[model samples]
Target: MHVQLGVLGPVAAWDARGGVVGLRGPMHRAVLARLVVARRRVVPVTRLVEDLWEEPPADAVSAIRTFVAALRRALEPDRPPRARPRLLVTEGPGYALKAAEDSVDAWRFEHAVRAAGELPPAEAVRRLTEALSWWRGPAYADVPEAPWVRSERSRLIDVECRAVEGRAEAYLSLGASAEAVPALDAYVSEHPWRENAWHLLALALYRSGRQTDALSVVRRARRTLSDQVGIEPGPRLRRLETDLLRQADHLDPGPGGPAAQVWAQATAAYERAVPSDTRTRLESTAGLMRDLAVTGGGGLEAARRHRVAAVAAAEQLGDPEVTARVIGIYDVPAVWTRCDDEEQARWLVAAAERTLRTLPPDGHDAARCRLLATIAVESRGALPTDRPASGGQARALQAAGQAEQLARRLDDTSLLAFALNGVFMQSFQRAGLSPRRDAIGAETIAVAQRGGLVTYEVLGHLVRLQSRCAVSDFAGADRHAAAADRLAERYDLPLVTVFTTWYRALRTAMTQPPADAAAAYRQADAILDGAGMPGLRHGLLPLAELSVRLRHGLVPALDAQDDWGPYESWVRPLLLVEAGDTQAARDALRDIASPPRDLMFEAMWCLVARAATMTGDRDVMRRAATQLRPAAAELAGAQSGLLTFGPVAHHLQGLTAAGW
Candidate 1:
C-alpha cells in the first residue's frame, strides 16, 4: 500500500522499497505527470487532450479514456474493473490523482521549500535539500513538449532555484562560504540578468576572504546589466559595492574565536623552555590543523598555503603520528576540490607514503597514511571513460584493497566506507551492472551511518545514485540524490556539491527535450568551470546523444582539441548529421575507431546505426547493427544498470527491425 509518484524527472511511481509501478507507456506516464502537477484538482478533458497531442485525432478523447483506465489499473491493481477509482477519481470534466499530499514527490518538495524560510539556518538547509532531492530531472521529463508542460516546467525550475538560494544562504550563515561559491557563481553566470544571485556571489566571495574577487563580481554584474539591459546597478547591489570598497566588517564571518582558543593551547604546549612533551605538542598541532582544514578551502591559493605550512610543520616534528594525521586531514579537500590538479594530489600521497615507511607497518599512523594515499589514487583515476587504458586504475584498486585491510585492523567504519567506495567506483567501469556494486553501496551507507560520518554518507548516497541511474531507475535515483544533497551541504563537501550539479544536468538531458536539456547542461558546466575543475568529458556526452536521438543539430560548441576520443568522436558525426550533411557524417564514421569496451558504446552505436540508416549507407548500418547486438542483448537482460542501456538498445533494435 506504499505509493510514491515522482514528476520532477520522468513520470514514475514506486513502492516503498523502490519497486517501480508500471504505467505501461509514455502516454500513460505523461497523463500521470500532468495530473500530479495539478495537485488533485481536475484537469479538464479538453485541456488534457491539448496537452497530450499536438494534433489530436477524431478519437483523441476516446484514446485518453483508454489511457486513464489503464493508468487506474496500474495505480491500484486490486480495484475491480467497474468500481470507481480512488487515486484517479473521475471529476466533473476530467480526472484527478487523489492520492495523499506526501505520496507525490513534487508536492512534498514544494511544501518543504515553502516551509524552509521560517526555519533556523540548519533546519532550512535540511528542508531545502530534501525538497531538491525529489527532483530527478526536468519537470515532467518523459512527457512530450506542449504549452501546459512547458509552462509547468518553467514554474518548477523557478521553485527549484528558490530552494538552491535558501541552501546557499544557510551555508553562508554557518561560515560555509566556500561551499556556497560554486552554486552561486554558476547561478549568476547562467542568469546574469538576476541581480540577486550576483549579490549572493559577492557576499560569499568576500566572506571567504577574497575581497578582490568580490569586487570583480560586482563589476561584472554592473557591466553586464548595463550593457545588456541598459540599466545601472540595482540599488541593493550598489550599496553592496560601497560596503566592499570600505572593507565592511559585517561582510565576513566574525573572527574564529574557537580557532584562536585552539591556537592558544598549541602555542602554550610548544613555548615551554624545558623539552616539551611530544604527545602534547602532537595533539595540539593536530587540533590546530583541524581548524585550519575547516577554514582553509574558502580559496584555492589560501588552501595551498595552509597545506604547505602544515607539511613543513609535520616534517619538522618528524612524528609519524602527527604527520599521518596532518596528511589525512589536509590532503582530502585539496585533491577533492581541485579536479584539474592530479600531480599535486600524487605528491601529497607520495609524501604521506614516505612518512608511512618510517612508522611500523601495522601501526595506527601507518594505517591512516594508507587510507589517505588510497583515496588520492582513486581520485587520480576517477574518470574511467576519459582514459580507458591508464595504469592508474589498476594501482587504485590495489591501493583500495590494501586500505580495506588496514581499515579492518583499525576497526574504523569511516575508513572502511571510503575504501569500499573506491572499489565500487572502479568496479563498474568495464561492465554494465553487478550485485557486488549494490552490496558495496549498502555496506558503505551502513558503516557511515553507524559512525555518524556525513562525508562517507554522502559518498554512499552517490554510489547508490549512480547505480540507480545506471539502471535507469530515475525515481529511486531521485530519492538517493536528496540525501546526498542534504549531507554534502551539512558537511560543506564542495566536490560532492559539484557532483550533484553535474548529475542534475545529466538527468535533464536524458529526460527533457533538446532545448531545455542544453540550458541545463550549460548551467552545470558553468558551475564546474567556475570551480576551477577540469571539464568532464562525460558531461558533454548527453547533448551529443540528444542531437542524434532527436535528428537535429543541437550540439554544444566544442574546442578543436575535443574533436577526437571514444566519446567525442561519436559526437562528431552527430553534429554533421544535424547540419544536413548525412553523407559527411557517414564518411566521418569511416575514420573513427570502433567503440571502446563499455555499455556507453551501446548508446553510441545505436546513434551510429540510426545515422547510417538515414544516410542510406546500408553497409555501415548493417555493421553498426551487428556491433550493437551483443551489447543490446546483455543490457536487455541486465537488472542492475538496465535503465542506462534500455532506452538506447530499444531504439537501435527498433531501427534495425524497420530495415536498413
Candidate 2:
C-alpha cells in the first residue's frame, strides 16, 4: 500500500514528478504536521490523534485511519514509480513516512544546519547556500493547524541567527568579505543582544582593510551591548576584537549569494514606500521605514540606509500618528548607529505618549490607531495595564474603531487591513466583540491573506484569541491559525504562523509520552523563531528547560546562574515534574515557594503540583491543583498559543497520576 508522510512542511505527498497532492480528512492536517516533524518515522496512531484532537472523540482511531488513507491517496495520485518511496508507509502500531532527511523541511533544515557546521569553508558556503534556498517563507505556511508541525517551524527559525552567522563565516572564510557584510549586518540589526554576528562583522571589516573603520565598529558594538540588556561582550567576540586589533590581511573578495534576494526584497519594500507622500503610500512605508531604522553592522548597511530613506519618507508622509509610529519602531531600540536601550526606551515613551496625546481628531485615523497599538505593545512593561494614562487598553479600542471607521469612509484596503489587525490586538486586552477584529480576522481572511499585514504580529494575537474562543466561547483557534499559517508561508514569517497552530495540536499531542512533548517543543520552536519578537524569540527558555527537567534529572547548582536562573523558576519545575521527575521536581518546588504574588499564583501552582507528586503529598498539591484547576480548566479550553492550562493540567496529573 502507498503511504504518505508529512514531517517537514505539512504532511506532503508527491509522485516522482513533484505534483501537489491531497490527504484524507478529519485530522489530516494534524497528522501531516506530526509526520513532517517526525520525518517519516513510524508515529503511533495514538500519537497522531493526540496531536490533532486534545480531548479526542471516541472515534479517534478511525479518524487516524481516515487521515492516513487520505495521505496515501494524496501521495499516490498518479503513481508510476509506485508510492513506496513517494509517500508514507504503514508499519507496526503506527505509520512510517517514506521521505528521507532531505525530503522534509525539518530534515532539510537540520541537514543545512549540520552541513553549515561540518563542511569546510568553501563547501560550507556551498551547503548553506543550498539550504537557504529551501525557505520560501515560514515552513508549512499553508498548513497552520498542527502543533507538531508548527513547533518544528519554530526550531528552524531559532537557528536563523546561527545560520546567518555560519553562512557569513563561510563566505568570509572563502574570502568573500564584501559579500558577507550585508548578511552579517542584517543579523546584527535583528539581534542587538547577540554578539557573534557583531564579532564576525568586525572581523569582516578588519580583514577587508578598513582598519580604522574596524576599530570604530568594535567600539560601537561594545557600547550598544553594554548599554542595553546590561552586559558586555562574551569571551568569544572579545577574542575576535583582540585578533582584529593585531591583524592584517588582503581585502580582495567575491560577490554575494542568493541572500541578495532578501536584500532585494527589503530594498523593494523601501522603494515602494518612497516616491510618494500620500497617506496610502505613507502607511505602506511606515513598517518598512521602521525596518530601515534598525542597525545592522556591515553588509547592506540595511538598517542605516533604510532608516535614512524611512526618515525622509516619514517627513513627507507628515501625519503625526504615522510619524510617531514609524519613529516608535525606530525609537524602540534607537541608536543613530550604536544601540542604546536606555535611549530606545526614552524615545519610545516620548513618541508613544506624544503620539497618543496629539492624535488628530480627524486625520489618517487608521494610521493613528496602529501607532497607538504599536506603542502599547512595544513599551509593554514600561506602561502597566493598571495605569492607562498613556492611552492603554481603553484608548486602544477607541483608536481601532476610529481607524476602521476612517477606512470604511475612504474605502482604503491597506488602511482597513491595518485597522482590522489593530482591532485583533486591541480585543486581546479588552473584552467583547470588536467589529475591526472580527470583520477582518474572519471576514477579511483573504485581505490579510498573503502578508498584506504583518504576519507575526497578527498571529501572535489571533492565536490567543482563537484559543480563547475554542476553550471559552468560540468554535476554534484553527480558523485564525489556518489563515495565519498561509500568510506566514507566503511571507516566510515562521513563528507567527506556528503560534496559532501549536496549542491546537497540543491538545492531542500533550496526552502522549514525554518524548512526544519534546518532539512537539522542537516543532513549536521552529515557527516561534520566525515571529521576530524578542519575547517569542526567547520563549525556548521555558519549553526547553521544562522538557529537560521532565526527560532528565534536574542537576542543582551552588550558583544561581545555571541555565535555569533567567527563566521563571516556578513554571520550568512544574513541567519537569509532570514530565515524570517527581523527586527533583519537589526540590525545585521547595526552592520556588514564595507567598503568592499577583502574577505568581499561576506559576506557583505548577511547582506545587510537581513537589506534591513526588511525595504524593495531597494538601499542597491539592491546594495548588485546586487553585490551579480553574486555570488548568481554562487551558483545556484553550486551543492555541501559549496556554497556561495544558502545562498546569499536566502538573495536576503528575500530582495524582490516578485520574489521568
Candidate 3:
C-alpha cells in the first residue's frame, strides 16, 4: 500500500521497506511490465500473453496468472507479514493494480499535466517543466515486446504530445513564443502527422514575428506528412499554413484569417463538382472522409479532395438529397471558422428542401427521408440565438412529419427500420410520456429487431431515448437497460460505443435516490476506461458529479467549479445537484438556465429547477413551476417518456411547480 510508484523514471515501484521490486525477470517480468504500465486497469490477459510469446503457449492463462501473482508478490511484499491486499487486484475480468493512484509515478506525471491546464501561464510552465523532468527514458523501455506494449507506447507518445502542447500553450499565453520554439519544433518533428501540433507551432512562430519561418515550418510539415503518409496536411492545419502565408506582416495579424475563405472555397468547389440525389461508393466515401476531416483527426487536403470527389459523384449520380446531407455536414466546419451563421443555416435548410423535392413518393431507401429528419432536428436546435433565424423550427417540424409518413408507409424491413428511427424523433417531439409516443419508440425497437440492424450505435440511441421516457413517466428504465445489455452482448460492442446511452440510463435510475440501479454501470465504466477519448470521458462528468455527492454525503454547493465540473460541465444538459445545498442548487439552476438555448440546455434547466425546489427554496419552486409549465407542455410532444437525466429538462422541471 505504501509502495513508491515512479512513472517519472522508467516506471518504478518500491516496497514499504524500501526494496526495489525486481521487475527484472525475463518474459514474466515483461508481462508484469505491461500490467504496470497500464496500471489501475485491466490489460486483457490474452493481450499480455500475446506479447510475452509470439504464439501463446498452450497454458497461456495459467502462465499469465502466474506472472501476475509473481508481480503482485514482488510489488506488494506483505507489509504486515499477513495477506494484506496485494498491490494488484483481479478487477472485472482482468488483473488490475489497485495502487493508491497518487503513489504511482504515472499519476504524478498526470498531475503535472493536469496542473498545467489549470494554472496561470507562469504556473503552467512551472508545472509542466517539472512534469517533463519526470521522463527518464521512453516509458516501458526495457519491457519485452507485447501487443499491449504497442498501445501503451502509443499512449506514452500521446502523453508526451500533451505535455508539449501544454508547454506551447502556456508559452503562447505568457507572450513567450520564443521560449516555445524548441518545444514546438521538437513536438512537430516527433509528431509530423499531428495537425493541431502543427497549428500551435505555426502560431508560435507567427506570433514571434517569424512569418517566413512559420510559413516554412508548416510547408515542411505538410510535405513531410505527404511523403510519409501519402496525404496532404489536414484542412485545419492547411488553413493555418495559409494563414501564415497570407499575413501581410506576420507580427500584425492580417486580413480575414484564412480558415473561412479557404474552407468556403474548398466547400464551394466540392459543391460545384457534385450533382444531386443518389448514394454511391464514391459519395459515401467522400462524405465519410469529409466528416472525418471535420470531426476526425485526418488530413485536410485529403478531406477536401474527398469532399470534391463526393460532390462530383453526387452531381454525376444526380442525387439531390445526398448533396444536401453532405452540405449539411459541411455546415459545422463552416461555422467553426466564423462563417456567417445564417449562411450555414441557409445551406442546411436548402438540403432538406431539395431532399423533399426529389424524395420518391414511396421510396424504401429512406436515405433522403432520414437526412431530411436529421437536418430539421439539428438546424432548428443549433440556430444561433443572437439572431433568431426564421423557419428552422418550422422546417424541422415539417421534415419530421413528412419523414414519419414515408417511414410508416414503406413496408420494406430495412427501410422501415431506418424510417422508424426518424418516426421516433418526430413522435417524441409530438407527445412526451404519452402512449402514442412510447408506442412509436417501441415500434422503432420492433423495426430494428425485424430488420436485424440492432448495432449498438442504433440500439444505444433507441435505449437512451427510451430510458429518458422511462424516467419522465416514473417507470422502470430496466427494459431499455436490458435491451442495451442484450445489444452489447450480441454485438460485443466496445464500452465507448454505448457508453453515453448507458450513463444517461444509470443517472436516471439514480434520480430515485439511494438505490444503485444495475451492474450495467460497472460495464459502462469499463467501456469509458478503454475509450481514451477526451469528449467521451466528458460524458462521465455528471455521473462523477452525482456519485461523489451521494457517496460522500458532501453538501453540493451552487458554484460550477467542482473538481469534476470543469471536466464535464461544458458538455451539455446543465445539472444543479443539491449537495445538501438547496440554495446553491437553486442558484445553479439560474446559472444553467441563464446561459443559452438548444433543447439540451433547456432540458437541464428544467431538471435543476426541479431539484432545487425539492431541497427547499420556495421562490425557486414558484419560478421552476412557471418555467416547467411549458416544458411539461413541450414534453408531451418531443419527449414522450420523461428521460429523467436530460439535465436541462430536469432543471426546467425543478423550476416549475409540480402541478404547473
Name the candidate that leads on TM-score.
1
Which candidate has the highest lDDT of all?
Answer: 1
Better of 1 and 3 by lDDT: 1
Model 1 clash pairs are 133-482, 471-641, 471-642, 471-643, 472-643
Q: Which stretches of candidate 2 lie over 4 Å from their true place?
A: 1-346, 356-366, 379-413, 426-440, 443-483, 495-508, 526-532, 539-541, 544-633, 636-660
CA lDDT of each prediction against the hidden true structure = 0.64, 0.52, 0.53
Number of clashes recorded per candidate: 5, 39, 64
Q: For residues 138-221, what per-residue lDDT tens digits would candidate 2 score against the true structure? A: 666656455665576667777766777898887776566777777777777668787877877887777676777767777778
Q: Score every model by TM-score.
A: 0.47, 0.42, 0.42
- Write model 1 residue lDDT over 255-341, tens digit each, in one string: 224674464466556586435545455445544554433322223323444565565577778777667666665423221212345
Q: After superposition, how far is residue 289 of candidate 3 from its true place, in Å?
A: 7.6
Q: Tell me, what's the RMSD of every candidate?
A: 20.2, 22.9, 20.3
